[model samples]
Target: MKLPIYLDYNATTPVDKQVLDCLLPFFSENFGNAASRSHLYGWTAQEAVETARQQVADLIGAETKEIVFTSGATESNNLIIKGLFESSFPLKRHIITAETEHKAVLDVCKHLEKLGAEVSYLKPDNVGNITLEQVQKATREDTFLITVMFANNEIGTIQPIQAIGAWAKEKNICFHTDATQALGKISVNVNEMNIDALSLSGHKLYAPKGVGALYLKKKSPATHLMAQMDGGKHERGFRSGTLNVAGIVGLGKACELARNSLLFENQKLSVLRDKLEQGILQNVSNTQVNGNPTNRLPNLTNISFGGVDGENLLMSFRDIAVSSGSACTSASVEPSYVLKSIGLSDELAYASIRFSLGKYTTEAEIDFTIKYVREVVEALR
Candidate 1:
């Protein structure tokens, strides 16, 4: 196995070689503003951008016009949540989201709260799954949007988004999902789930950062979100700025590759994830896997060691790269809010480690990680 094994794919993935290859040409030879409509260079750039838009759209079962590129999921989340609230729709003064959602969504909700928007932050069950009943009970006539995450980044708990989406549809309320960590790991069909909007970052898959997309269903209420940024109307006035051509190209290629290989690759990842989880459980004492065991991403696991400091344990394994919380929140010394929201004590929350596998993760790395983690936890105890 390679030294300094990377098991933090949920944080971000290394851009795949093939994705990189597709990105390079857009940076130089085909460099032109996609908005420059009068020249051949612009035409080439526009074609590439449109193709990438379609590639991104296909992954989520959305139309190309539904895809609006952004800086990343944070911007996408902000655009949908804040934009919808700021739009001309009167009486849409409330929003609902889970407490376990990424800070992007959570923070946006907080910001909206200060703007006189009624926000309901639903807590998850012990297994990190929020129930559809909870969402239904929280809904009100003024609740214009219900934003849930497709998967928990730290615990890999997959939410019942399909059910929530259907409920939202029945209620004639818009539903959105932050699918950053879930996109390449599972099938994300907007139609199948009745999803009106979704936020996804390219870096979470095999593409570069600073490029993501928000899927806003055509002719849906979600498509009418007010533009957050001001400039020449780009992305159909939903977001305004020059696009990142190279990153978009990379994101498109990554999506295409993931669509082609996700089924076969996710199965392999699940086997590796299970081996690692099981090995640690059997060999190490005072250890528990966080989140629902069966209803999670195939390539992710969050484990908590009862008697060890997660930070010290992480420090002990210099040869392994992992995280104790979401990458955006890792620098904070406090226990993970997501874990705490699911009923874990501060001690257990602080003791947790998030290990996310990816397309490039191998059996050798999983075996090595299992043994290494077991030894460290035992030694620390």
Candidate 2:
């Protein structure tokens, strides 16, 4: 087994070997400017990009033309939120989202708030869930968009996306979800969920980094957004930039693999995750699990130890690579806002650890982590 077991799949995933193989040719042999419309090289690259777009669309139940590639989920979130805000500012500027959202969504909302957008940041329940009732209560006549995360990145709590999406659709409001952590870990069908726009990242699902896609629903009254990146007017004039063919190919292959293996992988990961969670709770004193116990990603468990410093616990785990919180906000000394929002005290929040499993995780690794975590917590106490 590897010495340092990686239980932080939420931070990012190692690119799958199959995805790597699919993308390698684009880096050299098949390298071409996808925008070069008059040459064979351009044609090949464009074909690969379109195929990737289809793969991405297939995973989310979106139309092929609805998939707009971006740098990653952050860019996708910015494009959708900022784009929508830019398109409808001063007319319908109210937006609704949750407090537990990823920084990508929260930060974009905050940025928009400075420019006359009224955003309602709803707080989640103790289990890290934002009920459809909360969203309904927060709605207003001017609410143009309701953007919430499909799942909590830190705690792995899945939200009521379908319920909220249906409400938004009924009210003629655009609904967007940052599904970076939820996609591939769970089933996400945009049409069934009534989602108008959704954001996803490649690295979150065993694809290369710096590649993601936004699913913008196409209908009679199309979801409109101003172009965030102004350039050659690519991606149907929504985003304009030279495409990352290799990363896009990798993302497409990863999505295809995830679609095929999601069920088996979820079953496998849930078992290992449960074993790890139960083992630690049984062996360690004063340990409490975070997030919705039943409605969360299958492969993740966040637990807070009662009497250990979070930093010390992390530093002691020499053979385990876990996370204290979201990788995006790990540099800050503040305890996870996600845990705190879910009603954990400061000490408990600080001592919390997130163990996120993945397809490559094995039973042996889970066993080792269980024992190692018990020993470390016991010794720290």
lDDT of 2 by residue, 84-192 (tens): 8988888898999999998899999999899999999999889998999999999999998999899888898999999999999899899999999988989999999
Give the lDDT of residue 213 in candidate 2. Answer: 90
Determine which window of 10 residues in candidate 1 has minimal summed lDDT. Answer: 325-334
Candidate 2's TM-score reads 0.98
Each model's total of backbone clashes: 0, 0
Best by lDDT: 2
Q: Compose the digit string of candidate 1's lDDT tens values, residues 1-381.
A: 679999999889999999999999999999999999999988888999999999999999999999999999999999999899987346778898999998899888888888888889998899999999999999998889999999999898999999999999999888999999889899989999999999999999999999999999987878778889989899888888988999999999999999999899889999999999999899999888999988999998898889887668767878899988423344668788999999889888878889989988988888898889887888888
- After the best TM-score superposition of candidate 1, give how far the Cα of residue 295 lies from its true spot, in angstroms: 0.6
List clashing residue pairs in candidate 1.
Answer: none
Measured by TM-score, how close is model 1 to the native structure?
0.97
- For candidate 1, give the lDDT: 0.90
Candidate 2 overall Cα lDDT vs. reference?
0.91
